[model samples]
Every structure is written in C-alpha cells, then in structure tokens.
Target chain A: MATNLTGKTIVITGATSGIGLATAEELTRRGAHVIGVGRSVGRCRAAEERLAALNPAARPAFCTADLALQSEVRRLAGEIRGLLAARGPAALDGLVNNAGTFTYWLALTTEGFETQWAVNYLAPFLLTHELLPLLAAAPTARIVTVSSESHAHTSLRWADIQLRRRYNGLLAYQQTKLADILFTAELNRRLRGQAPHVHAFAADPGLVDTPIGQKGTPELVQWVWQRRRDAGIPPAKAAQGIIALLDEGLAPRPDTVYWRHGQPRQPSRQAQDAAAAQRLWALSEQMCGTNNGSLS
Target chain B: MKSYVLITGATGGLGKAFAVECASRGWPLYLTDLRPEPLELLAGALHRTYGVPVRWRACDLTDAGQRTALCEALRSEQARFGGLINVAGGDHEGLFCEQTSAQLRSIVRLNIEATIEMTHALLRLRDASETFRIVNVASLAAFYPMPYKATYAASKRFLLDFSLALRQELAGQGVTVTALCPAGLPTTPACIAAIEAQGVMGQLTTQNTGAAAAGTLDAALAGKAVYIPGLLNRLLRALGGLVPPTVVAWFIGRRWGAARRDLGNPAESSILVPEASPA
Candidate 1:
C-alpha cells in the first residue's frame, strides 16, 4: 500500500550512507520532507542531491554534524528545531536515530565517553531528548532507533559503562546497540498517554552490505563483514522495516516494539526490562548532561 | 621486497611505545588501530623522525571480515612483515557476575581471537627465510587465577600458553614467540588509577610502558620465550606459582575488592540519582 506522507517532516541521522541514506530516499519519495543529518558537508550535499533526484517535487534537506560529539549533537538539534519552527508548529512527524559506528578499538570522544557508546547510544539519546518538544508539537510522532541482534550478546555494564576499565571494539558496539533498545523502551514508557502521543520503536536491520566495516578494519574482520554482506540483504530492503514503523496508517502497536524485517519481534529480556530501561535512561541523561527537566 | 613490522593496537599506550621503539630501530612499520586520526599522526611522526616508511590502517580486529580484508589489502600492497606485535588487550574489572556479557566477549575476542587470527594471517604473509619475531602481550595476571578480572586473566593465560606452544612448534621455522608478561604498567590514566587502587602492591610492581616495550622487543629479538619486565613483577609471578590457585585467587580477590569499593558503585549512583523531571 502506498502511504501518502506529503505533509509530514522527518529527521534522520547518518542520512548520507547505508540504510540511513536509503530510508531518507524512501521517505522523501513517499512525499515526506526529510531533514538528513550527516557528518561531512560534501557527503550531505551529495545525499541531498540524490534525494532530490528521487522526488523532484519534495526536495530533501540536509544538515551536517558529527553525531559522535555531544556539542555537535546539541547544535544539530538546535538547527533541527529552527527548521521545525520555521515550518510552523507540528512540523516534525518522525525521528530516526540511525547514525552509528563500530570502532575496532576502544576510542574516546572529546567528551571522554567511548566513541561507539557516544555515537551509537548517547548521541541518539541526547538528540531525542532535545527534539522531544518538536515531536510533541505534532499530532502524532514516531521515533525509530536502529538497534541490532547483537544486543543479546551483552547486557548493560553499569560499573564501567563507558568501558574505561576494559575496552573492546565489538563489546562496545554490542553494549551501545543494547542501549538503543533500552532507550526506546524507556522513552515509550515516559511518553505514554500524553497528548499527541509519541511512539518509540527499535529496529533491527540485520546485517546489510554497507561501508561500515569496509575501511579501518583488520583483514580478518573485513573478510568476515564481507561474507556477511554477501549473504545479507541490501540497504533498501533493510530500510523497509524502518519505513514501516513511520507509516501512520499502520495499525497501532505497543508503545515499545522491536521491528525485524518489517515485523515486530521480541527483543532480549534485558531490552524489555522496564527497570533496566529506566536505569539506562537516567544514566544516559546523566552521561549526556541532559539531566534537565526537558527529558522528564 | 618491502618489509614492515606490523603492530596491532598501535595507538594505545604500550602499543605507541612499541611503535616509537621500533621506529628508533629504523624498522619500516605498519600500525593498525580503531582511530585513524591518531594512527595517521603517529605514522607521520615516525616517518619524519626515523626516515622509514610508515603505514597504517584503522581496523576493528574483532570483526572477522575486517581481518580478512586487512590481509588482502596487505597482500595487494605486497607487504611483508618481519615482526608482529599483538599489544591489544583489555579487561573489565569487577566481579564476573557484575560484568556485562559484552565485556566478557570483548576480553576473549581482542585478546584471544584477534591475536590468534592476526598471527595465523601474518604467518602466511611473512618471509620464509627471515627470522620472524612475534610479541604477544600477556600479563602477570596470566600467572594467577584472578577473581575480579576472571575473563582478562583467562584470556592472558590462553595467550601465554599459546605463545609457548607456538614458540616450540615454530622454532624449526626460525620464528620466535615472545610472551611479555609485565605487572601494572601506568600506560594510560585509567591504568594509573587502577595501579593506585591496588595500594602498595600496584605501586611496587608497576613498570614504565616505554621500558616494558623496549625490554619485550629486546627479549623477543634475542629469541626469549617469555619476557617479564620489572624485577618485582618477576618475583611476584614466581611467588604466585608457589601458591595454590585457590589461595592466590583469594588474595587477588581481596585486593580487587578494595579497588572496586574505592571506585564506588558507578552503576548504583547513575540509576538512583533521578534526572530533573520534564516541565
């Protein structure tokens, strides 16, 4: 069924490449206004051009920010808010927390958090918190956070959440992915029953062929990702699951749901735990210094 | 043939030290790490200082695909490694139950899986006629059954045993495996804090990262099977061998327990302290 989204505006992070870029293309093609966020100016401009090419009538917008840095994330949010305000109230229809990185080693951001944790988990957490007002202004808004099946590999490490004591690239990636699901669950819980209610969901795109592991990876690591990419679906196919969540006509589902291949599936027990979700929410707020009343 | 000495975790404290030491010796180098910016900076500095060819790639070694791609890339570049330094290893310090499954998995993947895979791949890429030196960074923890650092200690033990076995197996092929088992080295600020948390023992056993790197390479080139850096660390390893595994674990657990207490319960604090409610 072709869903008409002519009046809606959505923001997507990491929108210049992989599934993120694909999702922006799909949404814009469906007549929705896409505010694509990317790191590099050149890439963002290119992505904007591609989206415009996809739908000449609804030209997609682009914003540049390094989502890895909290300050950059805050600035990006302000820019998004400004755009939303310029379009009048109720402009934001959806938000897609899609930017992520798999650091091969433990690297820290300027903010002193692990790079994977900061970029994958905290960036989205902070961005969502910052943009909640714009989302709330809409009659109905949705949040789709891209998580992974790798969440099952690890639960939250409260003690060394930043992985300061021990650091492993894969483990850090898993921890951040798990955080995404937990964050989605808690956000849904908090926003429940509110006017213009917000629906938060976590999506597992599965392994798709992307530039994520193509560079800056060990030979063996690259080979493994390549094999997975060979067997995995393309980014366009994976974007379907995200697009499904953003479909307003789709039947109302649970406030917090994990979507896999465009279907709702059970996430890990830890991901579904309300208490853990709450804890993660609070911790995320603290880590991001977003403990202000804005995210209550 | 353009020969290079490849170092994993090359941007890290001990890894960086090893890079500098190798550069001092005028060895053409190839460094790999997760961070490209620092690796590039290090490579450029080394090249300028030593006038040797320095190359680097940012790679996540835990991913099997990246590892394969790295091998292919090196092969395509016609790169031959005369030495392989597996200096990348990490530990999540806490009770095993308190640690996340991800942390446990990382300890094994980076320390054991990545090490083994890198060695296997590089062994195929090394010059057959040349004497190849391999340095695997183990730890004094490898000699003990540590409680709080269970996974890390176990992974180091794997490296130590594997290095010894491989050393003997590859002796005929002119390859030497040197397992560097040093106690606390104040490599990073976190490591320095960890050492301080152990009180007197950590202070007494701690070795300078530069010295440790220098000593390990020197011993590896000398065909030593194992290199323990500090005298105090060597004595402790020997003493640890004299004690029963249970007894050693008990003592180490007590020490780590203190460290954990001093570090405080970061998990509890974050969860309990509520954020300001949304207006």
Candidate 2:
C-alpha cells in the first residue's frame, strides 16, 4: 500500500545508507520533498544524485553534518530552519532521527561524550529540540526516532548516566536505543493537546541487512554478520514501520508510541515509565543545553 | 579441538576469580588485559595448576584499533570460544560534573564499549553445535540511582539491560547471556576503603569475589537472565523496586555523600547536599 506524501517536506538523518536511505527514496518516490542528512559531503552528494536519478521530479535535497558533535547538530538545525523558512511557514511535515552508530570500542566524540551515546542518542535529541519550532509551524507534524528491541536489556542508570564507571559497546548502544524511546515518549507527553498537532514516535525496524556492526570487526564476525544480514529482512521493508507514522489515514495512537511493522507494540517497562521518561528528558535538555520552551 | 573460555580484565580481582574458577573446571583459558605482566603470570599459574592450555593477550580494550587487532589475532588463531566473561570495568566516584572528561570517557569505553566489542568478536567464534555462555559483570548499583557514582551506575545499568536483551535475541542460537549484579566486593584498596566507608550496609551487602564469579558462571550456564550475588543484595534489590526512584536517589545521595566527606573531597559534594540559603 503506497501513501502519497505530495506537498510535504521531511528531513531524515543518516540518509546516505540503509533504512534512512531507503526511507528517503520511498518518501521522494511518493512526491515528498526530502532533505537527506549524511555524515560526509561526498556521501550526501552521492545520495542526492541517486535520489535525483530515481525521481527526477522529486527535487530531493541533501545536507551534511557529523551528528556526534553538538556544534554541528546546531549548525545543521539552523541550515534546515533557513531552508524551511525560505519555503514559507508550515513547510516541515516530519523529522526522522535515524543516524546511529555501533562502535567496537569506546571512542569519544569531539564534544567529549561516548561516541555511541553522542551519535545515536544525544545528536537526535539536540537536533529535535532545536527544530521543534519549525515542526510546530506545520499544520500537522511528526518526529520519528529509530530505536531497537535491544532497549529491553537495561533500565536507566540515573547516577552514572554517561557510563563513567564501566563501558561496554553493546551496553552503550542499548543505552542509546532505550534513550531514543524515552525521548520520544517524553516529547509526546509534552506536545500533547497543543496546537499544530505534533506527534512523536519510536520505531524498531528489526534487524535489517545493513553495514552496521561491520567497522572494526573481525573477519569471522563480519562473516557471521553477513550471514545474518542475508537472513534478515530488507531495509526497504523495515522502513515502512517509520513511514506508517506519517500516514494521516491511520488513526492516531498515544502521543509517545512504539511501532513495529506499522503497528503499535509494547516496549519495555523502563521505556514506558513516565517518571524515567520525564527525568531523561530533563537530563537530555541539560546535557544538550537546549530547552524547547515548555520543557524548561 | 578443546574450546576456551575468554576472559577480559583478567588482571582485575574478579577476573582472576573467574580464571581460577574456570581453571578448576579444567577449561582452557584465553585471558586479556591492558598489562601483559599480570596476564602472563596469571596464565602461567593457571596452566601449571590446572594442566590446561592458557593464552594471554595484553591489549587495551578501550582503543578501537587495538580491539580490532585483538579480534584479528583471535580470528587468525582460529580460536573457538565456548564462554566469555566480561569482568573489566571501573568507576570514577565523584559528582559527574566534577569529573574530568577523560576520566568519564574511560569509564564508558572500558565498561560498555569494550564489553560489547569483545562479546561480538567472541560470539563469532562460537561453535553452533555446542552451548555458549556470556556472563556480564553488572553491579547491584544497576538497580538503584546512586548520585555520587552516577556514570558508573548508569554503565552497569546498561550492562544489565544489554545482557537480558541479548539473552532473548540469541536464545534460539543456544547462547545464554547472564548479568551478574553483585552489591559490593572489596577487590582493591580503593574498593576496600569504599566498602569500609559504607559501614553496616556495605558489610551486609558485600560478597567474596571468587564466590560471585563461580555463582555467576553457574547461573549463566543454567541460562538464568540475572544473578544477584548475596541474599542481602537480592533482598535489597527487591526492596529497591518497591520504593520510588526519587526516594532511592535521596537515600543513596545521603550515603555516598557522607562517604565522599570521609574521603575529604568537597568538590563533588554539591550534587547531593542542599544549597545554603542566601544571607
């Protein structure tokens, strides 16, 4: 079932590859204006060329930023605001937080945060907080954060939230994914009953055959990952869960909802905890140094 | 071909216990740590005592390049790992705002990032026909909010969650992930001091490193999702669940806040103490 997204503008991070790229292609094919965000200028340009080739009339755009850095996220947000403003008010229809990384070791971003925590969680957090006004300018808007089923593994560590005591790559990645869900839930709660009808959702695309967990991995691990990728679902198929949230025909669920295969699915108890969600929201705001007005 | 149990942080107190416990089981061992001398000594002792093959690698798990190098070495050796015990973790005890960026980053890298990479690398080496085990060393701190040990507690929380989540993800593949959440272990001088400072609560909750390691491995092999060492620790964890997190934070803040005072460090004390009224 194809849904037409004509006359709507959407921004997707990590739009150069995997599910982000697939979603961009799908949205552009449906006649939506897509501003694809990528890490490298070359990749962004390449993605732009590919999108152009796929749909000549789509006029898809591309932007570049290292989402791991707060300064870069702020800059990218400003660029997006400028682009949307030039197109007049009520331009942005959706924002997708999809850029993420799975590190094989503990690495720090330029801003001094754990790499996975910075890129996968805080980057989207700061970007969304910065772009809320633009989103609110639209008649109806949606924010989608790409989370994972891995969130079920742990609850929030309120004391050592940044993992100052111990570090594990998978655990760090899980923390970021859980943060994505909590962030979405808190955003939904704050935006509910507000004018402009903004909606926030977290989506699990399941394990798609992507280049994730390949960098810095051993050949044997890569081989096993390749096998898993072969058996896993395709990125295009996985991306539909995100696109479904943008569909107006589907009746709206709660403000903060978890979606899988285009249907709402229950997340972990921690992910659903209102108190944790609120606390995480406050902490995220403090860490990112952005208040989105009401949140402060 | 005899399979080995790979253990990280083999130079650490709990890591040593896991090594000894597995050696007693007559299992071949592959041990890694940042310091080569301790790992080599441990490996030689284990080999002589248990008559089992012991391989030692001196590599810093916090470095991406080094981690990749270690993974490549394991692949080239065609090493088959039947079990992986992630026991490498440390904590920077202070208000999160007061800690140096490098100190905080090291904790995250060592505790969370290194464990994930090591597990992924070793999981690739698993023999599909045999059962595989993974025991992650989380802390009972994973269950509560500790203001003074914020990042450390959060990292353990991550481990607890990741272990349970991976358990389900790999259940069909015959791999079991277990999280060991021990309350306290006086493993080092600093740990001993911290435990002593906690007074009665620490006395009641602390467990021996060897017992915790052995129990954790047994529970992991039994396919248990979580293993909290010590009866008191388990009971405290249950009680923790009943209290509101805010209350837990408040209580822990008071406890750790006093410990910091005993250490005579006021720089990190502001997080827990209420501010003084203006004159």
Query: Best by DockQ, which number?
Result: 1
- Show model 1 residue runs off by greater than 4 Å: A193-196, B1-279
lDDT of 1 by residue, B157-275 (tens): 89999999999999888799999888876655455556556666665676656567778888998999999977877777787789899998888777777777886733421111100
- Worst 10 contiguous positions by lDDT, candidate 1 chain A: A104-113
Tens-digit per-residue lDDT, A1-296, candidate 2: 24557768899999999999999998888878899999999999999999888877778998899898777898998899888777777458899999989764344443335568889999988888788877888888888899998899998777556452354557778889999999888788778745438888899888789988886533444676677688879999988888888766664585538988788899999899899988888777756766545445
- Report lDDT (CA) for all predictions: 0.79, 0.79
- As for candidate 2, its interface RMSD to one decimal place is 19.1
DockQ of candidate 2 compared with the true complex: 0.02
Model 2 lDDT at residue B261: 82
Residue-wise lDDT of candidate 1 within A123-241, one digit each (tens)? 98989888888888888888999999989899888866756445566787889999999888878777875533778889999988887865544456668778878888899999988
- Displacement of the residue A109 alpha carbon in candidate 2, Å: 1.0
